[model samples]
Target: MSGSVAFADTTFIRYPRPAAKVDSHLDYVNELLTEALAFSPRKYQLLPSKATMQQGRAVHEMKNGTGEVDLLWSMSTDEREKNLIAIKIPIDKGLLGWRTPFVISENRQMFKAIKTLRDIENYSAGQELDWPDVKILENNGLKVEKANSYEALFSMLEAGRFDYFPRSVMEIWKEQEVHASKNLIISQDIALHYPAAYYFFVAPAKRQFAEDLTNGLEILIRNGQFERLFLKYHQSSIQKAGLKQRTVLELQNPFLNPANMPLSRTELWFKP
Candidate 1:
């Protein structure tokens, strides 16, 4: 039976389509899924939808199996893994775990003194309402304020509603560029780190598709195409993050599911 794979159109995942209309991340996953079904008797189509984070998850969770969305790439948690079929391989090579703070440019000096996790605990952080990172930060004894939209979080921080917004190393620079009018600045003094993996999750009813995806990803990893694609998109972002120069404040991810044990799979994660 032929089926379709649907992806959420989010700022984090989807970029402006160039003349070639290739989204490096989306195309990589699509390639894996295409290679996966190549051995099967079925064909699959790729569907793109404009959905926010919450909408994407809700669509994927529909029990009737009639939701318009079929797949999502997000950080995995115990509760989420139980509800959907996760293709446990990390897509970003652990870049999501390397976090840097974003603060109003005027408040840049305030972060210079914050050297440890304890120092950060006294300040409020901002995250999206439905993000798993909120719980991860809260579990580590840091207070976090929630915003309903991605762009609003910057505005909230700018208004001093929150002290800082920690973003992924891969994303901070691009975001700063996008929101430069808000006078946002990235912290040069410290980096926050935890073990987090963003995985592709399929609808519960699509177990066979999940298996096909997993197999295809493994094949890509084996042939080294996975690394090629990751480096192609992220090399500059990683270099600019300057992780080695910053003081790292490591924390535990209480939401990480034990069954996934992402740390044990070194090949699937990026060390930088």
Candidate 2:
């Protein structure tokens, strides 16, 4: 409220999928956005969009300034950064890239014999068609089965369409529980690691607005609110991951651009 203005922009954010409720991912992002704008020099009224769309459609809407989605949170890729105004500072603190590969509990033995990247090359992985993970997997010489939707990926995995599915550490445990009946199990033998980030994006014309959000987040970081929020939502997931015990198969993330990342900020990232 430092600057007095007669009018303020009411920013529109995408609604969480499934309408009546939001998952922890969206819930955390929503609260983070609110915290960033809470004491900003400029006032912004945050409101969810009237309806929801898939990530692919949402990306198009954001790029075209379609008004249905004013802002989106997703894994940052080279293409997304180039087309939309990215906040640069990763909201997920680069945790999204740390993946856990899961498979049907009955078929978990598929990965048991694998010990190295070349050993797992013949096994196919499942990923959303539009996800940046697809390119990352392929870049590392893995075959990927593309799913059109997130929900379909698990069913496909059960059907033996793909050898396994790699999901982020923050997401796999919860999803495994949600689809408990599917008998999917996280591969205890090996996990996947990559350098990736998740970020907030805006339309190309909203560079100043993006900068405002970035500065606001920086303010939260300086005051310790940012890490607090992150831990509140993700700390348990980290502990449950037990990453130190797993044989992590590290992979290269060709999409991560060091220049666009706040690599200098050590406190912002999590190391396992």
By summed lDDT, the worst window of 10 consecutive residues in model 2 runs over 15-24
Kindly list the per-residue Cα lDDT of model 2 for residues 24-103, writing each as its tens digit. Answer: 48668878988997766676665666665666777788788777776778898888888888887788888898888888
Q: Which stretches of candidate 1 lie over 4 Å from their true place?
A: 1-41, 50-64
Candidate RMSDs in Å, in order, are 5.9, 3.3
User: Each candidate: what lDDT?
Assistant: 0.73, 0.80
Q: Tell me the deviation in Å of residue 71 in model 1.
A: 0.5
Candidate 2 deviant stretches above 4 angstroms: 1-9, 13-22
Q: Counting only residues 3 or more apart in sequence or on different chains, how many pairs clash (N, Cα, C under 3 Å) in candidate 2?
A: 0
Report the backbone clash tally of model 1. 0
Residue 234 accuracy (lDDT) in model 1: 77
lDDT of 2 at 167: 82
**Residues 1-272 of candidate 1: C-alpha lDDT, one tens digit per residue:** 12223223211112112211222255555665556555543445555544433633453443236554567777778777777777878888878889999988888787677778998788899998878899899999999999876767878998999988999977776677767688688978889999888788777777666676677778778888878877876788889888898889999998885556666778878876
Estimate the TM-score of every prediction. Answer: 0.83, 0.89
